[model samples]
Target: MTNMASYTDPTVKHDALLLFEAVDSNPNGDPDNAGKPRTDLETGHGLVSDASLKRKVRDVVQFQVDEGMLSPADRYQIFIRRGVSLNAQLEDAYGALGQATGKGAKADFVAKSAEYMVARYFDVRMFGAVMSTGNASAGKVTGPVTVGIARSQDPVLPIDMGITRTASTQEEKKDNASQMGNKSVVPFGLYVCRVHYQPTRNNQVSEEDLQVLWTSMANMFELTRSAARPDISVRNLFVFSHSTSLGNAPARKLFDSVTIAKVSDLDLPRTSTDYTVTPPAAKSLPDGVTLTTVV
Candidate 1:
């Protein structure tokens, strides 16, 4: 874990490019369409939402805390958590300070509460949040780290297959019977996601925070296992750190420098080995910028 104090710098900006692959797994499910894998209707390309990716990162951080890798008072709490009420958390925040958790709370108090939330929640500090619920409103913080939606390098084939279980859960089954179910999967896909860190946004994301973010992305799929997603892995992670907060080069240009292509002979690709990745040369990088690759 990186020292928490290291993230207080407010003038360091960063851009990252990630390449990952999924095999026979549903990376992101679409609730609008019966929990199927999300896809582009016209192009058939698989889609993984930025929220989904961020959730994975958050899960990793939470897991670290659970494993005692982080301390309780480390100010790395999770704001958007599962099985927890936002209002309840907000009330607790005010209660801790012996302040009224109501809409009529003083403006300065609200501002202070918001700062408290930022200091307590790692996600809030790095990704920002809208801490307004009921009588308690801590306002909003625009997180410094921004993640873009991930898309496959090529169009993916979504396959729906039927499954069955011989054992039934209910006592109503007198005899051994089978349970029927269906699941969706992508045969294979390599996805690309972009991440940006704006130092001027919150001045909360430090070099250590960025390292944790990278580690989270690199190992997210491996640690978060499920029947629906079992074979996803990170293939490449490219980071571009600029010396100045404003940055020296365009983000798109930096992204365009890296190229990924499938093997010319393979009609259908099933793994990361089937593709070739071309990263830009270090000398080609713009002045006042450094690149790091973690694969």
Candidate 2:
């Protein structure tokens, strides 16, 4: 009894399980630890920050919008792109509406600017933004989507592989003709992430917006390929859509229904086949909830 209808409806609450894998890649680097692969010191489990995953999602949406793959193309503009000025973008809202930015008009200006931002930028509508900086101050918006950090199912081992560059920066250095460096990577790891969507009136998340979010997540790694993470990919995306906006069951319960365990006698998993991933049985779901497999 899994119903696909209303799953993308913004009025209902949704919870998603994102399973992705990395083979010989650095999924996320810790700047605090000299760009090493992020890990938990106590358990040695691989960790990928929610911010890193969101950035990839954003990049995916932006790429699709730029290529005219998504409809209503003007509304899917990305606000947090590199080399773009947030203040400048915020200021444009006032300019577009021809609104004044004086102290007397500050409250209205902020409200209108925030509304304008929500309508124009896809990320602002879905991920929210803090636009209260610089000359134009749009009030802070709480997004409908919340992404949790991704953690490996088992303990991971991150190693640094030594490499050397053929050319040196300085031509005068005759004896030292090459420079050496190390790349941090995990041999293999399967990570699980949770993304929750709770819609509200303020952000105005639509069904089409949810489509963009889901599509972006499914193709996040493919569009964001890099030398350090060429083998990363999305293995599964399990979406749970509630019939009501308040939700029919606790998210944790739904998440628990889907179990993941290592195959018997197989240790040190190197591929997805090494583990057994089980989604919830059709009858196991709570009332007014539907589970949809998107990948």
Candidate 3:
């Protein structure tokens, strides 16, 4: 692939920073804690899991395929999607290869099934999967991309508000007019997530795939609005592309170059403007590394 501002070589190493903000929303709710925002009790910092972020990315890609925006739809199908049976999908792979599990057939069937999955599923190629769960087993593939958990820059306050519904579900209890519920929200927060991409010879990750990934990430929240998360958005997407597949600098070094600090004047950050974001200086980057602002 040629060097460019937005699209870079998919085979090379990549480090990215995603800075997003949430206003009056629960970015990610911890069901374990009564559907409240996940947080570090020791530090009060809000948390958003890597799995949640990837699910958003996967949803965006699935939307694209559903709308016929992505051509050759079979190539971008989602494997870990909702309402889909994993074992059934694995069986399809074996059927496609005309192979049945029998004596001495396990190894060959697993190999071909994994390859078939890599070719058909976009998430498997980018985020990887473990398909060795059921009788129809396809070995796992280490994906090229990995996302880290997102952490808020400052401590967040989760406010649980009591809500009421005017109508009751049961007709027998019509006189029990109002029902009580709870809503969880964060007044405001700024979160940063780190992601890395390293191409391996086993999977097929193309330049077009990378482009779609970036596009989906940038708009991950646009079409995913809900009552619980109506004000979440991507504020910045910084991608550092390395010239060589091995990478010219450690990912930590590249990530540290970009700083996100709260403004001195703000006692509590309530909006994105309360914090200042600084991208890595082009001249300060190591040789053979280029930074691109995809968002």
lDDT of each: 0.83, 0.89, 0.89
lDDT tens string, model 3, 143-237? Answer: 99999999998899999999999999999999998999999999999999999999887549888899899889999999889999999999999
Model 1 quality (TM-score) = 0.93
Model 2 earns a TM-score of: 0.96
TM-score of each: 0.93, 0.96, 0.96
Candidate 2 structure quality by residue, lDDT tens digits, 199-281: 88654787788988988999999987787888999999999999888999999999999999888776689999898889998
Decide which is better by lDDT, 1 or 2. 2
Q: Would you list the clashing residue pairs of candidate 3?
A: none
Instruction: Look at candidate 2 and tell me the lDDT of residue 172.
Output: 92
lDDT for model 1: 0.83
Query: Which ten contiguous residues of candidate 2 have the minimum total lDDT?
Result: 100-109
Candidate order by lDDT, decreasing, is: 3, 2, 1
